[model samples]
Target: MKGGILLLRSIAVISSSVATIISTMLPLFLYVSTPNIELISIFILLIFSAFLIHGVLTHALNDYTDHLSGTDTNSPAILSGGSRVIQTEVFSVESLGRFGKWLSILLVMILLVFLMLGYYRLAVLLFVGLWAAVAYSVPPLRFSYRPFIGEWLCTFPSVLFLGFAGAWLALGSPPEWALQNAVINALICIAWVMVHHIPDLDADKNAVPPKRTSVVWAAEKFGLAWSRLPALTYYFLAFTCTAWLIPERFWAGAGVTIVTAVSALFIFKMNVADPVQVSSYEKIMLMLAILNAVWLGIFI
Candidate 1:
């Protein structure tokens, strides 16, 4: 029973749910200041659905596929490796794969629910999120095994949709401000995710099919010292967006700017050559990314 509990915890990866929570709450705060009981109840269900899609299904496929491709097997076993359930011997690869399949079915059921309710927009967004998670890790597409494509095609859109989720569900469409904020949040997310890839470079390269994340590709093309480029590039993009928005949303923009600047500095100073050190820094990066999301939700 104890082992089963720990295995479940490993795959849950609940710590990563901060982005979904913030994304859901942002629209609720902006659109439903005094939401009725029905709206609030629906909001709660929406949050659950988001978690089911992202935190559970996404991680399930990721952990299962990475294990199959040997990336997780060779992973540095820090923040970068897939969840450590398989490594810890609490779950088998087949079991994890089965879990992913079950979750996929569940996600489709939720998507159908939205469709039946005429929430076509929400259904489409959820479908996109599902596609990203599957195509990113599963066979055929396996975008996560390639550089740039994974983050840009998979991670970016999934997160952008998540940021737009609350507003879309509540207002039936996100306002300009919400859209801009969603873009910024997505940028910050991908930026930090790039950093998260740094420590896994060696493990990824050594994987069976070679998970050449953008960070790994940059390191090979430029040098390990330059692996920071991909993350820095995204962070700079996020910084530029926030800077552009400063004139309109002063406090919110300023909050993101300060946190982004600090995060970029950390990435700049990161010792990319040391997997252990880079792994340690990823926790801090994750914190800053969450802070950016929180600030956007509250102040925007």
Candidate 2:
């Protein structure tokens, strides 16, 4: 029982749920005004379905693939390594792979249910999540093994869709407010993830096949100091989005601006070689992101 619990928690399912749940719930709060039983039910289902695809399938596959590539084996970071289940011997590699495979089958079944029930948008969103997960870590098209391709092509779209999901489900089509929120959230998500990768730069480079994340690529091409470039570029982009929103939304925009500044500062202060400090900063940034998401929803 303890091992089972450990395995589940190690996957970071709850952590993954934070963005999607807030994204969905806030839109429901803003648009519905008073959510009916039907709305509540749909909300629950959407969140559950997203949990299946992202929290379960995506993390599971990523851990499995990273383990196979030996990245997790070499990782020194506290937070950015693949789930430490295989490293800790909580589960064997074969067992983790099977766990991911079964969860993927379950996700496909849920997708079919959405299609049959005329929830085409939900199906499409889930498919994006599924593709991002598989393509990110799987062979051949292993986007995460390359540089910018993984974050821009895989992580960005998946997170953007998740941000758009609540608004789409509530309003049929997302409003400008919702789209802007989604874009900001997606950009912030990318930013923090890049920070997460910073601590793993050396380990990623030394992986059997080389993880070659954006941070690693930047360090190799632009020099070690430039390793912070990928994450800073994204934080700047997220800040730019808030700047555009300030004219129409003073207080909310101001709130996000403060949070975004703090977030960027954490990255700026981060010692690229210090995994402990980077991990500490990563935790704070995550809290700030959740706060920013709530602030966005409240103003919406």
Structural similarity to truth (TM-score) of each candidate = 0.89, 0.91
lDDT over C-alpha atoms for residue 18 of model 2? 53
Report the C-alpha displacement of residue 167, candidate 1, in angstroms. Answer: 1.4
Query: What digit string (tens of lDDT, one per residue) describes model 2 on residues 1-300?
Result: 544544444323433345645755675765666457666776676677656666567777888888888888888838878757778888889998998888777878988999999989978988888888889987888899999999998988988887777668766887777787778888888888888898888888988789999999999998987888998898888888877788887766787688778987877788887889988888898877777877877786
Worst 10 residues of 2 by lDDT: 7-16
Provide the global lDDT of candidate 2 against the true structure: 0.78
Error of 2 at 75 (Å): 0.9
Per-residue lDDT over 86-112 for candidate 1, one digit per residue giving the tens place of the 0 to 100 score = 778777888878988887888789899
Error of 2 at 177 (Å): 1.1
Q: What TM-score does candidate 2 reach? A: 0.91
Q: How high is the CA lDDT of each candidate model?
A: 0.75, 0.78
